[model samples]
Target: MMKKLENFAIQDFQNDLINWYRNEKRDLPWRKNQDPYKIWVSEVMLQQTRVDTVIPYFNEFTTKFPTIQALANADEEEVLKAWEGLGYYSRVRNLHSAVKEVNECYGGIVPNDPNEISKLKGVGPYTKGAILSIAYNIPEPAVDGNVMRVMSRILSIWDDIAKVKTRNLFEEIIREIISQEYPSDFNQALMELGAIICTPTSPSCLLCPVREHCAAFHEGVQTELPVKSKKKKPVPLQMAAAVLYDENGQLYIHKRPPTGLLANLWEFPNCELKQELNKTHTEQLALFLKEEYDIEAALQPLIGTIQHIFSHRIWNLSIYFGEIKSMESEKLVQVDEETIKQYAFPVSHQKIYKMYKGEI
Candidate 1:
C-alpha cells in the first residue's frame, strides 16, 4: 500500500497533475476564489447538475446575490426563480433556510467551523467537509461519488464503494492525507481528475494525471473497479396536464403547494390521470375533473402529449388545451401579475410557457 501510494507523492507527478489542471481546468466563476458564500452556492447548484450546465446558472446566481446577506434578504420567490429548471428544488429551499440561519443566527457571517456549518440547514457531512477545506482550508476532505471512485481505483479496494464500510475506510485514508497546507486545492485536484478523466462510463486513463499511482490502472482493471449494484427499472406514471387559454390569449395557471418536488411553483392545472380509463375514458375524466374541482365543463380534443421523465417514473403527460364555453364561468378565477411574479414554475412548464408568456 505504501509503495502504491508513493505515486501520488512524486514531485514530477504532482506538478504534472497541477499543470495539466491549470491548462485544461474549466474557467468556472466558482473556482476563481475561496469565497465561502460563492462556494456554498456552487456546491448546492452542482448537486445533480453537470458542471457545464451549471456554469451559466452559477454566474447568474452570483450576479444576483453576491453575499450571504443579499441571498437572505432576497424573497423566496426570487430564490426559487433563480433555481428554476435546475431541478431538485429542495436544495434551493435548504439554501434559503441556510442563508437565513447565517444572517439571523450568526450575524450574517459565514461560519469558519465545519461542524458549525453542518448544523445549519441542509449541510451534510460531504458539504460540511467541502466548506471546511475549500473556504477555510481546514484540511478536511469531502468524499463524494467522484472521490470514492478515484480513491477506490487508486487503492484497488474491492469492497462495495457505495456501502458505509467503504466510506469509513476512505475516510480514514483521507484523514491521513488531509493537510492544513494546500488542503482545498489538493482535494479539488482529486475531484477534478475523477470528474473529467476517471469518469464512470469511459475513463480516459491516458489523460489521467496520476494514473501511475492508480492500482486499478496499473493492473489494467480500471473499468471493472468501483462496482455498484444494478439500478431498478423506472416505473411508468400517468398524469393529465391541462392548459387553459381564454379568447384574450391569457392562459390560466395554478400555483403548486409550498412543499414537495416543485414547491411554490406555478404550473398548468394538472391532476393524476389514472390508467383505469380506456376507450370509455373521455366522459369519465371530464366528469371526474368537474366533480373533483368544479371545472365540470366537457373537454373537446387532445392538444398535445409530453413525456416527462423524472428520477423514479415516466409521466405520460397528456395535455388538453381547451376554452371554457361558459357553462357557469365560475371555474376560472382571475389572478393578477403580482401573483404570477410571486411563485416559481417548474422548468418544463417554463419551456412550454415561453411560447405563451408574451401573449399572456
Candidate 2:
C-alpha cells in the first residue's frame, strides 16, 4: 500500500498539474467556453471515443443544435441522423432524452447540484463529476478510464481498474487530493496527462509534469501499476440483410424498434441467422420477408458481406438484393435513393447501401 501524499506534496502536485494543463492542454472546441450544455454534450460524445474522431462530430452537432433548447426541440430522428457514423446510438439517444428533460424541468439550464444532475438520464458518476467540476467549477472527482490510469500510477494503486469498487476508491482519492482552487483545470489536466504522457504503453514518464510526485515512478513500477483484466471476446452473430426494392426502384427500409440495441435507426430489413441446416441464408431471408412483412420476393444473388463489431457483439451481415414480388404489410416504406438519405441507418447497413451502389 502506498502512503497518501502529504499536504505540501499535494499542493506541489496540484500546482504542477494545473500549470502544465493551462500551458499544454489541447485547444478542443469544448474548451472554448464553460457552457454546461456544450460540456455535457462533449463529455457524453467523448465516452469510449477518440479525441480526433470526435472533433468534427462535436463541431457539427453543436453547430446544428447550438443549445439545450435547440437539441431538445429537434426531432429524435434528426438528432440520430446527425450522430450517424459515430456508432453507440444509445449515447445520443440518452443525451437527446436528457436534453428534453433539462429543457422541460430545468428551464433549459443544466443543473449544478450533483443530486439534481444525477437524476438526468445517462449521467453516470464520471459524467456527473465532469459536469460539476469542469462546467460548474465544483471540486468533484471526474474519474474516467484516462483519469483512473493516471491516478493508478500517481498513487501506485494496484487495484484492478475493471472493478467498480476500485473505481469508487479512486474517486474517493481524487476527492481528497483534487485542487479545490482550480477543480476544472485540475480534472482536465489529469485527463490530458493520461492521454498524452501517461499512455497505456511506454508512458512518457520523463516529460510528465508531476513525475516527481508519481508513486509508481518512484517505485520503478509505473508500467505495471494499473492492472486491468482482459475483456471477454465479443460474441459473433451471423445476420442476413435484404435490400429489397419495388418496381418503381424505390428501396425498402424500416425503423428499428423504439427501445433496444440500435433503437429507432433505419436499416435494410435484417435478422439473426437461426441457420436451419437445410436452407441457404438467402432462402431464409425470403422466408423472413414473407413471414414478417407478408411480402413474396424474388431473392437475387448475394450482394456481399459486411462485418461490423460492437462492444459486445460482432455482426457478420450477409447482404442480398431482392425485388418485392408482392406486398401487404405497411411496416416498411419504399423510398428513392435521394429520399433514403434522409433516414439514419446503422453503420453496417450504411455500408450495405454503399456496396449496393458500388460506392466503396
Candidate 3:
C-alpha cells in the first residue's frame, strides 16, 4: 500500500502550497486566463523547454495562431515556422493534428473528459492531467518531472522517478492529496514549488511555503529523495552537408520525409559520413547529391561546422559550399535567402544559411 498523509496534513500542505502559489506565481501569459486552448499550447511548448525561453515563442505562437480553430486551419509549414527553433518538431506536428481533430469532432471545444482528451495525439498522462485540473478544475494529477520532484520531497517518495511505475504512484498520491477546491492552483503550486523552491539540486528549503510539511526536508535528505536513473549520453554523429547553390545564387533545399525525426523540415542536402566507404566528407557529399538527387556538384572547402544536440543524438555537421553542375530530380527547390525564409529549416540548416552569409 502507498503511504498516505493524515487528513490534517494533506489539508495543510494544500493550503500552504495554494496560498504561496497565489502570492508567488509568476505572471505568465498562459496563467492570464483559463482558456483551454492557450493552456494546451503553453503546456506543449513548455515541454523540455525553459519558461524564459518559451515566453517569446509562446507569445508569437499564440499571437499567430490564437485559437484551436486558427491553429487547426493553419498550414503545416506555417505551424512549423512558428515552432522553428523550439526543436522537437513532432510536438507541434502532433499538436497540430490533434487540434484539427478537436476542431472537426468536438466543434473546437477542448474535451474536458479525461478519456476523450487522453485520446488526442500527443496528449499523454502529464498533459492530460494538466489540462483537466488546470483548465477544468478537475482533481487530476499533473505529475511531470517538476511535480514528481516536489511530491517526492514533500512526501519523501524515494522511488526511481525515471520509471513509469513511480510516476503512476505519484499520480495516485497526488489524487489523494490534490485540493479539490482549488485544483488549478494546487497543480500549478506543485510545479511552481519544484521550479522555484524544491529544485533538483540544493532546493530552497528555507523559502518553501510547505517546508513544515516536507518529509524530505525534515529528514534532511531533500536532494537525495527523488531518485532518477541517469540517461545514456547522446550518440555523436558525423554528417556532411552541402550548401549547393545554382547559377542564379539560389540555395538548394529539400523537405525531410513526412515522418520520423525532423520530419517535413527543410534542410540543405546532407548525409551521414560513412566511415566504411573510405570517402572524404566532400566526396561523400558528392556521392549523396548524385545518388539522392541525380545531380552532380563541384564540392568546395568547408565553410565551418555546426553542432546541434538532440535528446539522444548529436549532429556534428561539416558544411561545404558547392555549385550545382547538373540537375535531374524535380524534388529540390532553389531559393534566395528571402525566399528561403518562407520555408522552415531546422536550426542546423539555419546555421548553414548564416555560415553561407559569413554571419557566423
Instruction: Name the lDDT of candidate 1.
Output: 0.75
List RMSD in Å for every model shown. Answer: 3.4, 1.6, 1.3
RMSD of 2: 1.6
Q: Compare candidates 1 and 2 on lDDT and give the better one.
A: 2
How do the residues 243-306 of candidate 2 rate in per-residue lDDT, one tens digit apiece?
A: 8887888898999998888989999988888765578887788888889999888888887889
List the lowest-lDDT window of 10 residues for candidate 2.
1-10
Error of 2 at 302 (Å): 1.4
| Candidate ordering by lDDT (highest first) | 2, 3, 1
lDDT for residue 334 in candidate 3, whole number 0-100: 81
- In candidate 2, residue 75 scores what lDDT? 94
Clashing residue pairs, backbone N/CA/C < 3 A, model 3: none
Clash totals for all models, in order?
2, 0, 0
What's the lDDT for residue 124 in model 3? Answer: 98
lDDT of 2 at 245: 85
Per-residue lDDT for 238-345 in model 3, tens only? 999988888889888899999988999999888999789988888888888889999988888887888999889999999999899899997898888688888888
What number of backbone clashes does candidate 3 have, counting pairs of residues 3 or more apart or in separate chains? 0
Give each model a TM-score. Answer: 0.87, 0.97, 0.97
**Cα lDDT, all candidates:** 0.75, 0.91, 0.90
